[model samples]
Target: MVKAETVDKAYEIAKERYAEVGVDTEAAMKRLETVPLSLHCWQGDDIHGFLNPEQELTGGIAVTGDYPGVARTPDELTSDLHEALSLIPGKHRVALHMIYAVAKDGKKKDFNDIKPEDFDYWIDWAKKEGIGLDNNGTFFSHPNVKDNMTVASPDKNIRDYWIQHGKLTREVSNYIGEQLGQTCYNNFWVPDGFKDNPIDKLTPRERMLASLDEIEAKDYPEANEQDSFEGKLFGAPGIESFTVGSHEFYQYYAITRQKLWTIDAGHFHPTEDVSDKFASYFPFTKKDLFMHVSRPVRWDSDHTVIVDDALLRITRSLVRDNLLDRTHIGLDFFDATINRVAAWVVGARATQKSLLQAMLAPIDQLKQSEYNADFTTRLIETEELKSMPFGAVWDKFCQDHNVPVGFDWMDNIHQYEKDVQFKRN
Candidate 1:
């Protein structure tokens, strides 16, 4: 089949899927007019030529209608973006996800390695490519970089390493805070806990200490106030040990005692290796971690999964635990098959909705209860108490506002229920 016809056919099929479920793919696509990079969390190491930020469909609504003429090179991609930008309706914009795995020039460290004027030129290039950092001008740091060191290297004791790293990282954060102003700093999530036996590897407590140092760093007094430090659920090359229960709580107390952590939703599944068949073990107190949203396919945990009721209930539990004070819920996602724009909206709407879901609890009464906070906490986590009713109420609430049952509906979520309103800050 000719490539142009093939693209068109895909667009049509996506549209039909949305129609089958009653989504207005056309209007939703309109919401995708301007592409925002922050909405996407996919990063590092791959370089796929940019395509339509509108190359996404959500709630079953297909945004891009198949452009047989779409170009695949960097130059063509930028031109396509310019043309697409013109068609967007109002102040609204489409969302663009960061496809880091497709990094052709190698995971972004070398923008202009050859030219000495790299930094200035790279910023311009970033703007053109619509590239954005989670927070501005932020990068990871370890305690002994001058010595060519790292935070969780195979050589050090877990706790002490964090202590040194935490102090140093905080200093760097101050620098970022002073430079970026209102922008939050971006944090990578490689500090959960460790799995493979590395006797001296850094501990989460130490990691938290370093993170807190960054938050309260003296150089940037407003470090904590300006942007959050995003902590990861897994350490990756190996999972971090400070996951759930008391250890995580230790870090949560220490960090919030200093700043904020954006909890990613899907980190709970660490590459989604769970099986309904076996007893699964989770390491962190789902409540203690302020989360971002992501879902994994089959069992892949780190992949940011789409937000839904099941994920909401977990956040609701945090409110009961009084843990929300230390967390920020961002929509972290990557959908290879869907348009990046649609995925952004879906994740955004879901986080906003989940925040409100916590508000729905009888906050008035909970305040009066003895373990008021404890009661609220139980309201969300005590499995026996929160089941069918919580979900039923939530589903109905979403319906009132115009959220889809799944990714089956397409269009701007025009149906938000009456008392709910979300504003982007």
Candidate 2:
């Protein structure tokens, strides 16, 4: 256990070091509080939403490992989420898929038939927890998906079914936002693609656009609900050839339609630096951006995030360019190999740590050095900042937030597993 006094002393020393570089530790911590990460609900249950837990996870989504104690009900999922949130510093929103809706009064609803009332339980829970909610339309793992398509399917019936689901999802999202007094981001992503190189790729994309247009026809106030479109590079086995909604597709769609564009870190090529794309979009994007932070190994593996170089670059890009206000950060990884609650705590804290490190950087000095063409100073100072007492600042931040400092949180997770998760079976 790390003593609070030791944490305070280390923070004081770290504060003075950062002061030498003209950085305000207090202000950095304060700024971090304003940016909240939207934690994905699917991670708690491995994407097996309550609507149909027996359904196979389709649309190129796959969660490996037989880690016991996965949440099997809405209550279990939320309870696990509460446990995860307790360990993570700062208030954050929970992102829900339409499939997670809780039925009421012995009533059940499918994706297309579910109403906002179906999500009342989640809304009430969020209200009590003082957190916000985000939502997504479930486009896969349902009977309507034909030939690996939903909205872009050649079958109008299949397309219309999903279109209705999309519309209802937006309604539910808007309701949740209004109920919670926070803006709900409703994101749309489909697994419409072909296994073999389709001779007619343009037609599927055209159909997808029309379907999305129909879904967006009924608009809600941006204050209550904002819509986003997520694209992909490739998908599961059958979707390897052609993804109808590629990054290019959504980029144009989002800009032209004035909707938010989602950029999942794993949805791009392994070599691509998603951080670099922010500057490219910030100039012309009239609306805010949404990001799904995940670590992809070789392909879209959705590995648990650590405080690695890619994450650092991403958080640094946002901080250095002052784009935190324009971007909504969210987690998108699901790893069933470890303790589920521990995975959430680790990923969330890693993200928080990266953001803190970025906040602690001497960004002003680095920018001035760049503006003056002092490459030597710019390079050296960036490297020097890496060696500074960043862990102390992070520990202080954790202390201030009343979350565990350092690895002490792991002990709590083990106890929870023994008392709560392990008893699930």
Candidate 3:
């Protein structure tokens, strides 16, 4: 166990070190506590919703491991989520896919037929936890995903089905927000694309645009419900030619519609850095943005997040621009190869760590150096800031939040698996 006196002493030392660079370590910790991270629920269940546990993961997405303790029912998933939230620091929201809805009296509701009542349990749970909720419209791993086309399908009925689903999801999001007194971000992501190159690309794009128009036509109070759209570069393997909701498509749509466009960290090319997109897209949109933070290797595989340069760069940009309040950050990775709860803790903590590192940086000094054309000083100070006492501050933050500091959370996770997760057959 970390002693309170030790944590305070370490923080005192870190405060003085950051003070030399004009960074207020105490204020940064308080500001970081206000940042709410939306944790994705699919991680607890390997992206298999309660609607049908046996359904094959389609849309060019796949989960490789069959790790035990995967939540099979809504109750089990909720329990796992509670466990994860306890291990993570700060009060956070949970991001849910529409497919995770719990039907009334065991009666199943199709994606389009789902009502806000179906998510009553989630709203109630969030209320009990004193946290907020966000949601997504599930457009993949379903029978309606014909030829990897939904909302962009040539068939009018198929397009209508997904369009209805999108509208219904917004309604549910509004209801959740109203019940919890917090805005629910309803994000849309479609796996509409082609496996190989297609000559007629414009036709499908036009159809998708029309479908999106219909979906967005539903009027919901902006105070309670916020709408956003996500763009993917391509599918897992087969759908490599083009993804209809490519970054370009959603960027244009979001700009014109004056809505949030979600940037998934792993949705772009492996070599391309999404941190650059903030400066590129935020000007045109001129609206609060959304982000689905994930880690990817060679492909769009939703790997667990770590305290890496990419995450630091993304958060650093947000902090420098003073856009953390306007930006909604959500975790989007799920690694079923390890303990699900542990995966959540690792990703959430890594994200928080990156944000702490960013907040501790001397953005004012760096900007002044740049404005004065002293590029040499800016570069040198930026490089030197990397070795600052960030870990000490982070330890204090965790200690203040009453969460396990350093690897102490591992003991809780092991005990949780033994007491709560492993006995489930």
Residue-level lDDT of model 1, residues 13-88, one tens digit each, is 6555544433444443332222222343331101132322322321111122331233344344333333323222
Per-residue CA lDDT of model 3 for 1-425, tens digit only, reads 77879888988998999998789998999999999999999999988886776788888778868777888888899999998999888999999998899987777666777889889999888998889999999998889989889999999999988988888988999998888888999999999998899999899999999999999997888889999999988877667998888999998999999889999999998888888888888767677889889998888899999999899989998899888877999999888899999998899999999999999988888899899999999999988889998999999999988899888899998898888788885
Give the poorly placed runs of model 2, Cα more than 4 Å off.
Answer: none
**Best model number under lDDT:** 2
- lDDT per residue for candidate 2 within 343-413, as digits (tens), equals 88888899989999999988888999999999999999999998999999999989999999998998998
Question: Would you estimate the TM-scores of all the predictions?
Answer: 0.45, 0.98, 0.98
Q: Total clashing residue pairs per candidate? A: 63, 0, 0
**C-alpha RMSD for every candidate:** 13.9, 1.0, 1.1
TM-score, predicted candidate 3 vs. hidden true structure: 0.98
Question: Compared to the true structure, candidate 1 yields what TM-score?
Answer: 0.45
By the lDDT metric, which is better: model 1 or model 3?
A: 3
Which pairs of residues clash in candidate 3, taking residues 3 or more apart in a chain or in different chains? none
Which ten residues in a row are the worst by lDDT in model 3? 104-113
